[model samples]
Target: MESTAIGLWGVPLAILAGAIRVSTPFIFVSLGETITERSGRINLGLEGTLVFGAMTAYAVAVMTGSPWLGVLAAMATGAVFGTIHGWICKWPKVNDIAIGIAMMQFGLGLAFFLGKAFIKPAAPHLPSIPFGAWSSYPQIQAALNINVLFIIGAVLAVLLWWAFRNTRMGLILRVVGDSTDAARAIGINPDRIRLLATAVGGSLAAVGGAYLSLYYPGSWNEGISSGQGLMAVALVIFARWNPIGCFLAALLFGGAGALGPALQSVGVSEGYYLFYAAPYVMTLVIMIITSSPTRSLSGAPGALSITK
Candidate 1:
């Protein structure tokens, strides 16, 4: 009876740890998407960028035996992908969303083509901070191996939140996103701002991909990313374009993701595969709840087509 009670208590605690673990990628990806969407551009090709980033990071780490170099390589690749999306979108009559989808296909193809040789290679893993070193339990230690990207992502979110409100550059970005005419009146180039924003967003999203390959799953393959990239798009909407909200929402998603495994551990094994859909289900539910068919949701940039 005592063991049964202890198991029940442990379930929630395990879920919390799982939330922290699973949320890291969402946090990074959603934050990256937030920046792009804030600039009135959307990169649906982030899925491709993410997978390619994972491939690049893993390949570089394996070749150089340094995980940090892998991260740099991933960032560079992501930037290139973003630049491509931006460059193409600058053409008249080109749809940014469609271009994004195309980029996704391009990214995936490139990743698979280049990553064919890296399928069997072993790579150095990212270093984790020992937050649970004081604990004697193995589960505690496992949880403590929290990735550095998680901390960096948290700090980045706070910095971005502050920048959006208090920085000159951020103001310009807002102007561009809200209205191209307004940006032109202020001597700002809307195209340039959006281009830069998309590039940065791509770079950040790649970092999330790097985290997945070099840390969590700690491997590389065509399948490294499931629907994480697409799900991040939905997360950006649920967060209402708030970086802080992105963090919290990602944690909730992570917890939802962990539900199946956590439940399995306690002898509840039915519907295991279905648990994977919990995050998506939650995202859809939130979108329905917050959506306004008649009026745009609050804080949405006026120039964004997604809100329309």
Candidate 2:
């Protein structure tokens, strides 16, 4: 794809493509976090899980020559990590947030130590759908290249939003999240539900990591994730714990993050670097806008407020 062939429209088209590519991880992580938070637990260690999952996915893909298998491995490891966090936090007087921080460092160190041999290996990349193939323009073709995971993430968002409202399991999760006493009276174990929710969240976050290593930037590195896991926590909050809102917010964040590269692609390089900070800046702004000391978030679980 030559820049001369792409007109001024290339910039926006490129940004749109970048937004979809960049948003995949955010969508997975934010949706996963929504599930965890809805069950009244927050996993701050997801950054570690995300990175570690990236490493695991790359290593597995290199060894097995199957990107999908690598993704499965990452999900399994993430489940283990989540289960550990849940188990530790269930103990008397244990602090979930503090444990999550410790786990973050632990995951990072472990990944770097184990992934040294995998740094140089080439792995199979995930496949994408060329939505713009009908167009003669190269820029359009490149811009509309949508990956399988992004499509799955988008569908999952809608499914989750619907499930939360209509499913019996969803009702149980909501009840467990809202009040411990109420859950107990209803014969549901809050600890157990939170544990399962956290485990599921961990797996989902890992899938996001797999997408990063197997597609998009499409490589394994220590810095593959730029605090996206942490950013997703605020995103879940900003979305008011709604699954559909999480999906849309991820796209917004993704588009913001993509603004810099999109402009640079069109030869507008000078100030585009500043736009690279869009994701972080947007996260901070949304957090400030949504936070209130006296009132809980509109859709927040009642039990989660005590942690604040």
Candidate 3:
């Protein structure tokens, strides 16, 4: 079947499609970080974790011929990385930021060294839902081919938003985030809560990585994450640690990320490359606008060191 081209109209369609496709990773990473930050901890090493997860997922998919298994493997490894970071930061006098940075380097180096063998092998890809089947246009079909993980991420966001407002666990997380003394008064262990939160965050971040290698880019590469993991830290702040906000913000960021590729696809070659930087530029702008020397961000966790 021949693809139906719609001329200039393809640009917006491509961007709409790309936004959904590219936003999946951002959605996952930002949601993961939202959970971690809400629990009063920050993991700057998520970039390393993201890359390492991509490598792990790709390697496993290549060996096992099952992308789902690869995703599981990535999640397990990510949780372990998170556990290490959480445990180290729990030590007296240890700085979470410093430890997070170290873990990021460690994850990156380990992934690069071990990923060398599987770089060239083709891995099984995750399946997508063909929502555009009724359309005759190929671009519409491509745009509507929604991945399973994207749906999962969307559901997860709603679930998380509800959980934060209506669950006992959410209450505990909030208490711990607000104050260690308050958590202690309530017979809760702040360190334990933070550790578990970090581990959960790591697992989710890894899922984002798996989406990259097994779905979108569909390959293992050293630079696959494109600093998206680090960017998620900023995204969590941008979303005010709200799961629903994270989802919407991820979509916006995804659209910005898609700008360059969408323009190039439409034959707008000149100056299109610069649009690739739109997401990062947007991040910087958001940070500058939100930051204030005199007042802490409204939704920031009281126990979070960055807020202090």
Candidate 4:
């Protein structure tokens, strides 16, 4: 009876903890997509990249006994995938959307085929900092146990925001995104710029994947991503392409995601399954509220194919 009473209080703490944990992947993926779209291109195949990165991270960790090394390996493979997508989309006749779909399918199939061997092995999980050590309550301690990647993602958001507004590279990227003709007139190679941007984006998305397989779920599973990669595209739109905005939006999505499990923990089992739809419903509502058939989204890159 006493534990049940504690459980009631634990519900909010659990949700708070879950929000931070779940939001980490969203932060990385959405920020990555932001970079890609900011370069006047989009790669819808990050879903595949996320899945494959999970598989690769798990496999490498199992082999090398170092989770950090696995993350580096995932980034390398993800960049390669992004490079391929960028190269194909640069062709005049190819469609970026279509090519992105193809790449996604290829990544999924490849990951599945290669991931079978690593499923049974136990790899080292990423370490976390006990921010809750100052608390006497277990729930508080648990809620405060922060992951390193979450901190990294937060710092990255601020850095990207600053870089976008103040750096020379940011100027070039903005010029390319706003107008290819403008970029060319300025003697900038838009294609090369976009390719690099996409590569960097893919690498960041893979870090999100690494977080999944090496930390949260801590396994190499084909189903780990749960469509987070695809939904992040919507997240980017919701964020208005701002890195800091992406971080906040990711936390909102993560809170929605945590709703189901949080309620379950507190004995609110009735209709708990419905809560799983919270994030999707939130996404739909955000899309409806933000989208207008008459005009491109405010802050969208002028040269972006999606906006056109």
Instruction: Report the C-alpha lDDT of model 3 over 199-286, residue by residue, as the tens digit.
Output: 9999999999999999999999888999999888888888898999999999999999999999998778699999999999999988
Cα-based lDDT at residue 23, candidate 3: 94
Clashes of 3: 0
For model 4, how does the per-residue alpha-carbon lDDT over 242-301 read when each residue is reduced to its tens digit?
999999999999889999998888778699989999999988898898888887799999
Overall local distance difference test of candidate 3: 0.92
Q: Count the backbone clashes (under 3 Å) in each candidate.
A: 0, 0, 0, 0
Which prediction has more favorable TM-score, 2 or 3?
A: 3
Query: What value does the lDDT take at residue 86 in candidate 1?
Result: 87
lDDT of each: 0.87, 0.90, 0.92, 0.91
Q: Which runs of model 2 end up more than 4 angstroms from their true locations?
A: 1-6, 305-308
Runs with alpha carbons beyond 4 Å of true place in candidate 1: 1-6
- 1-308 per-residue lDDT for model 1 (tens digits): 53355556567867877888788888888888888889888889999999999999999999999999999999999999998898889778889889989999999999999999999988999988989899666566665668898899889999999999899988988888888799899799888888898899999999989999999888898888888888888888888899999998888999999888888877887887688789889878977877777887788888886765
Which prediction has the highest TM-score against the true structure?
A: 3
Candidate 3 ranges with C-alpha deviation above 4 Å: 1-5
Say which prediction, candidate 1 or candidate 3, comes out ahead on TM-score.
3
Clashing pairs in 2: none
- Ten contiguous residues minimizing lDDT sum, candidate 4: 1-10
lDDT per residue for candidate 2 within 237-285, as digits (tens), equals 8899999999999999999998999889877859889999999999999
